[model samples]
Target: MAVNPPKIKVLLSANERLQKLKEAFHGKYKESPLFYACAPGRVNLIGEHIDYCGYAVLPMAIEQNILAAVSVNSSQTIQLANTDPKYKDFTVSVNEITIDRENPQWHYYFLCGVKGVQEQLGLSSMTGISCVVDGTIPASSGLSSSSALVCCAGLVTMEANQKTISKVLLAETCAKCERYIGTEGGGMDQSISFLAEEGTAKLIEFNPLRATDVKLPEGAVFVIANSCVEMNKAASSHFNIRVVECRIATKVLAKARGLEWSSLQKLGDLQTALGLSLEKMLDLVEEVLHPEPYSREEICKILGITTEQLSKNILSANTHHNLICRPCVS
Candidate 1:
């Protein structure tokens, strides 16, 4: 989670993308970048969904990554520009680094990372930097592109500020900061991005934030083809709806057994509280919950709470805003 060592001219010549990004930084800011930071996009080989549910996820870092060429500045403003013209440039004062959750722009994701690092280090005055970003990962393709960008930004901020932190802490901070953009991630993307070693995949688990190496079969290749279908998880409700559904389902099950349901969120945590095996959890799901979608009223009634109470208990802010029939205000 520190600055990548300065690449000599020959090494820069060897890596075209790095060379190009360095040139882009010079072109945009008219100054040589001090250093570069990069974090790779990851594709989950298995269990992407269960990561947020307190389960381990298997992901491998892809070559495609978000790269930033950065130079510390005395201007007191963090400026960002992307190699891709479609992503417009952004600038914000170091003291006013705020994330706009309502608008999940590309820059907000980067800001999420910067803000995370700033908060973690408790830096009263952060070092402003001029950054030119380049990314090869396809956005909205389930390749963890946004998370990679956040990780890269966090790493860059740490370096620019001359701060030091462990890779695990950096990963955890990035994962939490992404919530500023209104995505509740389970750390698979950030964890794999930071902890991945070349030639090996990782099984990422949270709570303690540990990674276990998973050796793939020799000569195995994972080819990912994008259909070009695009949906920003932060901008769309489809992703968070599933998260909310899981939260409500966990609470529903907890309430059915007379447990303090509001405190429960993930199904895994609920099962842990009940001390039930996966088999018993399945049986409990069968006995307590239904296959079909439950109406807002039905959900409230099942939890023995009012619509307002249910609304407060069952959702994160971003997920709550997406509810079709938002609980009525009295």
Candidate 2:
């Protein structure tokens, strides 16, 4: 017998908040004034550290998503509420592009989207909005909860303003706004979240900002086991470090070969240009750096390196806990 994978869904129960939201705007306008939009969270299957370097990444939008409830207000102040009452309401002006420090820690991300949209359309002022946001996307799990939230907010705001908003523009606005969160991500999450089709993976090429949808193989199940280790893109400098390291490596390799790094179109091209196998590249890296590469005790003995040095280098590289490889889903 074939085993079934676990299914997850957003479960919103009938409660006081739901009743109040319905009552607040049931017949307020001439037509149905309520607007709803969904934005999905993204999962990166491979190409983790290569996005900023203009490499191809494979990602998919999961079932987890953010659903937004929005209504336009006559005033110039935007008001937002979360399902968790402890999370304070966020209020900001359409004219003022300032960061909210008190309420949601991800407020900067939203502010970025709002400002981006305003700048994109040359809109001097946006109508005030009352929005209630709820989502099933896991926060701080390497899944793109922040991007989904920003995309959902942007969509509602655009709809409320009666403007034509393209998905490409929405993704760009969300990614640009998320920079306020203090992490320099390459816009993969927002792009994938907005454009990804269900049951398909997207291959995104950075710099030029192109996406290709690739269907997943039939009868294949994707198992995403969270190691319970979470890394915050904004709070941690680790992601940036990996980006810089890859750039440095690329530049060094290019200079050694008397060629520009931009000329190399693919990662495999870089390896071929350097005439180095993956193991040989690792060995060269060990030689260039002070300590040797990561190796088990027996492997170190075979390579004639001291175990202590090998262990220390491995720790420095954080190889022990890294998500090294993932199977191709498309």
Candidate with the greatest lDDT versus the true structure? 1
The RMSD of every model to the true structure, in order and in angstroms, is 3.9, 10.3
Q: Per-residue lDDT of 15-71 in model 2, one digit per residue for the tens?
A: 444454444434332333366667888889988756655557899988888766677
Q: What is the TM-score of each candidate against the true structure?
A: 0.93, 0.68
lDDT by residue (tens digit), candidate 1, 1-77: 23232333447888888889989999999988888888999988988578777877889999999989999978999
Clashing pairs in model 2?
112-177
Judge candidate 2 at residue 204 and give its lDDT: 83
